[model samples]
Target: MSVIGKMLTLLRGSARELGESVVDANATRIYEQEIIDARNAILKAKSELTGVMAKEMQSAREIERIRAEALRLEDLALEALGKGKEALAEEVAVKIAETEQQLEEQSRVHADYALQVGKLKDLIKSAEAKVREHEREVAIARTTESVYKATRSISDNIGASGSKLLNARESLDRIKRRHEELADRMAAAESLDKETGTRALEIKLAEAGIGGDAERARRVMERIRARKTDAEGQ
Candidate 1:
């Protein structure tokens, strides 16, 4: 194919795919609409079937009327023959034959109507059964779609919550590390202060001649001086 033709084909494919995607997305709605359409069709068929049945009944009534007329004519022909009227009886017999023929034709028509009505009824029944099954399937599809949406929402929320929990845990860990570092610094500072304070107090005592080897040396020197002066005086 030429480039333009290929491009057109690609566009057509993409369009088809897009259409299918949209249809799939709204499949449940479409199925429900289809069920409604099927029900409407069944109702229309039933109405038509009712008309056919009415015609069949009318045909049956016509047949009965013809049969009654034939019976009445037969009785009239019998009375005419009993009264010695051959021509009138012959005329009555012709009417009886005509009525019988009419009855036969009406009965055939009625039978045909009855057959059509039966077939239509069976077809309508089967169509209704199929529609009912489709309705049930649509119901199940709707329920399943709802369940899938709920599950998807829950899964999305769980994923988001999991991320948030991870962030919170990291923040907690950082806080703990900072607190531990601060505690260490404070402990080091406290130890250094104690060492510095003790050294400063010892230096002050030594300068005031109050505590250590220097004071003991001064006392020994004073005792030696006193003994020498006593020996010279004696």
Candidate 2:
């Protein structure tokens, strides 16, 4: 491989890492926003419950006052009847009956209000449960996110390291190719010298009666001419 190819590989790996980081940050931000929204909903539910309870208490107090006024008017009517003033006593009795009816109606309204308050309290309780559920969901999501982040970190490190190793291997291969080329050139340069040394050794051997140099040279020349003829035919 060439230097340019190795550089491009490194750049691509770095870009992948950057992309992964951006995605992780975006996910974390989204979870954070969800947590904030859940908290706000819990607070709002609590505030509304407080206001409802306050209004319920005020209604209860008004009902109690009406009940006390009804009892007082009834006592007044009895005292007037005992004094032998029939017409005035009858008027007081009528007023007492009206007050009693009003009190009864107020009592029913108060009871209804109390029931509504209880339902509101139950609603608040349900809201609290929802808040708890949201919290648990958030915790689980966070745990999953942590695992994902850890896995991604491991993958990123491995990818970076593998990229470096590939670059190194490409460098080594290029160097090895250059070394082989140099060796081939050097071998070619020594070929003539090697042939001259062999010829000299053959001449000494022939002088010592091992064989004649003329015969050896003739055989060698014949072999070379045979190879040339074969090449020309091909």
Candidate 3:
């Protein structure tokens, strides 16, 4: 890959890793928030239940008052008849009939309310039991969150330390490369200096008349000594 393309790839990889690390590190907080939300939902449910229970209580009291009024009307009608007041008795009989009708309708309504109250109670009981059970779950979740948080914290620290180490290693490698280059340049400079000194010395020797002929004479004498030495050995 091109240098820029390679760099972009590295950046993308690093970003992805960072995002994953952040999510892992914060998972505990997310779970804790969820638990809080669940508790809040239970509180809201109880609040609504309280309102409904209040209305139910009011309705129960009203039913009782209506039932008591019906009883009173019946007693009044019987008393009127016992007093030998026929017209009064007749009037009271009509009132009793109307009261009885009202009582019947109220009773039907009260029966429905009563059944609903029982169901509401059962529902509340079930919900409370579920909430209590969920409390245990929440407690366990809290412990899990703590464990995950500790693990994530250690992982994050290790990851950060690894990144720093990688950067330090890269920097050390670059410094080593630079030092090698400097050493190469210094070696080249020293080699060039040696060559220049050798050439200058040869020029000076030639000026002093010792460049070629004198060296050739020395080689000739060396060959003569080699022949004599070989002849003696034989």
Overall lDDT per candidate, in order of appearance: 0.76, 0.69, 0.67
TM-score, candidate number 1: 0.56
How would the candidate models be sorted by lDDT, starting from the highest?
1, 2, 3
Q: What is the TM-score of each candidate against the true structure?
A: 0.56, 0.50, 0.41
The list of candidate 1 runs beyond 4 A from truth reads: 1-30, 163-234
Candidate 2 global lDDT: 0.69
Query: Which has the greatest lDDT?
Result: 1
Best by TM-score: 1
lDDT of 3 by residue, 80-132 (tens): 88998779978877887886787677667667766765766666676566556
lDDT by residue for model 1 (94-143), tens: 88888888888888899899899988888888878777766765565455
Q: How accurate is candidate 1 locally (lDDT)?
A: 0.76
Error of 1 at 230 (Å): 99
| TM-score, ranked from best to worst | 1, 2, 3
lDDT of 2 by residue, 1-234 (tens): 443453345346754454333233454466567657756766776787687677778877877887788788777777887888788878977887887788788778777767777876676677666556545544554554465578788778988787533577889999999999999999976886656777767767777757786678878999999999999999
